[model samples]
Target: MTLRVRDLDPENPADLDGITAVLRAAVPPMLVTPELLWWQSARAPAAQCHRLLLAEDEEGRVIGRGSTGLAHESPEPGLAFCNVYVHPEHEGRGAGTALVSAAEEYLASIGARTAFSWVLDGERNLGFARRSGWSPSRSARFQRLDLTAPLRPLAPPPPGVELRPATAFADDPRPLFLLDAEATADEPSDVGTELDDYEEWLATSWGHPLLDRDLTTVALVDGVPAAFSIAHTDGADRYSSGMTGTARAHRGRGLAKLAKHDSLSRARAAGLTEAYTSNDTENAPMLAINEWFGYVPAVTEVRHAKPLG
Candidate 1:
């Protein structure tokens, strides 16, 4: 009946599979392939100092997992995050608390002055966060669309605009990066981020394992990327909208919607049966866009923050 939390060795296949199993059991909709896990927890740049931890019982079976890392892209310093998840069958154990404690200690040791975590919107999860001295800050909604159903046809782009797959920019993704950076700065979030380092963005985001370039759609205004819909696929039937945004200059042109529509159509054609995306509760425009695309509310999670001296 004993339980212990330990840092997961990224080089160990057993640990990777164990975490993957935990994720599958807890969050079935979000796909977590080995490649995606490695890209996130292992290949993260040294600046982020990402750490993945697992909680195991006396039998050495993984029943919970935690992820901790700095918000490296935030222009504001001293911000970090730690999210903990336990198997439903093992919720009453101390694994979640131990993992969160370890995460806060590690972050504090690394110079973090404030830590953030996402707790599923529920009485138990909220109660746990409250007991740990964390307060809810912002909430986000996860939405999913049945890609197997017929999607409304996308309207044609303006005469000067053309819709293209993100793969078209493979030889040079910097343009898309610029668009992403601009759009990201405008997106609603408690933890604001700016993509200032091109190399870092290239290493972490552009090179992410789940990113599906061929299915990602972009709107080109006279051959310049004006809006884009970044897609992440699990190599199966699941697809996620990593981001769907338009540059400020192109906001009123419906370029963002065009990009997302095209991306969703391509994803369905690619045999992806499910589409998932998350939006800050206050992001009304994005929320309306998702609703138009037939995405239904799946779950909500509140961002909890705790200040650490």
Candidate 2:
């Protein structure tokens, strides 16, 4: 019963099914499909440096998987991530450790100075990471909203801001991309990310399949994009907010709330009955906005960091 780690080909349907199963088992609250998995791997920026590795048992079943690479946009270089997941039923079979070892070696080969991972908050999960030289650093919560239930009527757009759909930028989306990059930098997190490569951004984010351009809401202020709430759907009732953020300069104006409300209203109208989103526990402002929109915490995941020797 040997375990081996190898690259996962997005073009292969079997790879996607295996990866999706691991994702669902590891993080059941987060929705995933073949389309979403392929889109994510296929569109990763070749320059920013992304890699997805899968662990297979002797029988050729994927028992674990990891995504390892450097976040080039981050101001700090060598910042890499690798989350290894072993199916709950197959824990302690050496698959998880083997997966992490492969991911770490790959990241180190790519000049990664630090490796980050998200571990499901629990005794066994945390203990595994600790034994492997990883330490808890930060935490985040996943929340879900019942879109089918009655929701508070969203207020009209403010005096100078207008609620608009992201589809409006289809003709030219560079502006929205720039806004997304800017807003992401201000987000509270243990791993600070900076979006520097435009082309990679186009491939990884702009080219995502689940991104619902029509349902994403952007708040415009005098022709400028101040805030936005991005939505991703799985062609069914499940919907997720990729991000909802307001520009630093426009933080006090409640544009994030306005944008998110518009997004939720549009999502409900579009037949999405369930909405899920995650937020850093320290991001009080964003959490408040989500709570206002009827989002309730569903799960907690902890960020773990391991310093290389």
Candidate 3:
């Protein structure tokens, strides 16, 4: 009847699989894999104090997991984060509490002044954060579309723009990386991140295990990447938009829409049927683009923040 939290070892077959299993059991809709998990752990920034911890039962079965990391790259400092989840079947035990406590202690030790976590916006989930002193913040909605559904045909690219696959830039992904940095700096988030490290960007974003280069579409304006839709596929029937964004200068020209539409079409052509994306409720431009693509709101996740002394 003992419950304890311990650091996760990505190299350990049992630990890695068990962690991914717990995540899948707790949040089935999100895509996670042992390989992707390990890759992230390997390439994470050292200053971030990023750690993935596992909660194990008496029999050595990992039933819960949590991820905590410092926002090292964010322009706003002192922000750390943790999101703990337990298998529904294993709830009511002390695993959740143990993991959360461990996470808070780790972040505090690293001088994190504030912590942010996403707790599903529901009575039960919100109740947990509230009881723990966390307050509600902004909310986001998850949307899904059936790739098999009839989609509004995307009009041909504008005069000087053309659709290009991310794979085409395998020899040189720096352009896409730059575009990603510019777009992400503006995305709605509790944390403000500005990507500045090229190597880190290559390791974390361009070389991610789940990112499907061929399925990712970029809109090139006169040979420069102006907008892009990053895609991740499960190699099965599902695909998701990791991010879709356009540079500031490219706004109002339907470039983000064009890139995403092109990526969705490519995903469907690749035999993926279900596609999903998430958007902050206030991001009208992205929300509108998703709607145009037939993506309907499937779930909503609320962001919860708590300041620690």
Q: Best by lDDT, which number?
A: 1
User: Model 2, which residues run further than 4 Å from truth?
Assistant: none
lDDT of 3: 0.88
Cα TM-score of candidate 1: 0.97
Better by TM-score, candidate 2 or 1: 1
Top model number, TM-score = 1
lDDT of 3 by residue, 198-288 (tens): 9988988898899999989999999999999999987788888899999999899999899888888878888899998989998999998
What candidate 1 gets wrong by more than 4 Å, as runs, is none
Give the TM-scores of the predictions, in the order they appear: 0.97, 0.95, 0.96
Which wins on TM-score, candidate 2 or candidate 3? Answer: 3
True-structure Cα RMSD, model 3? 1.3
Query: Which tens-of-lDDT digit does each residue in 1-309 have in candidate 1?
Result: 798899887777888888888887777666688777766777888988999889999999899999998998898999999999888888988989989999999999999999889888899999999999999988998899999999987778879999999788889999988999999999988889999888888888889889999989989999899999999998889999999999998897788899999999988988889999999999998999999999999888899999987
Every candidate's CA RMSD: 1.1, 1.5, 1.3
lDDT of 2: 0.85
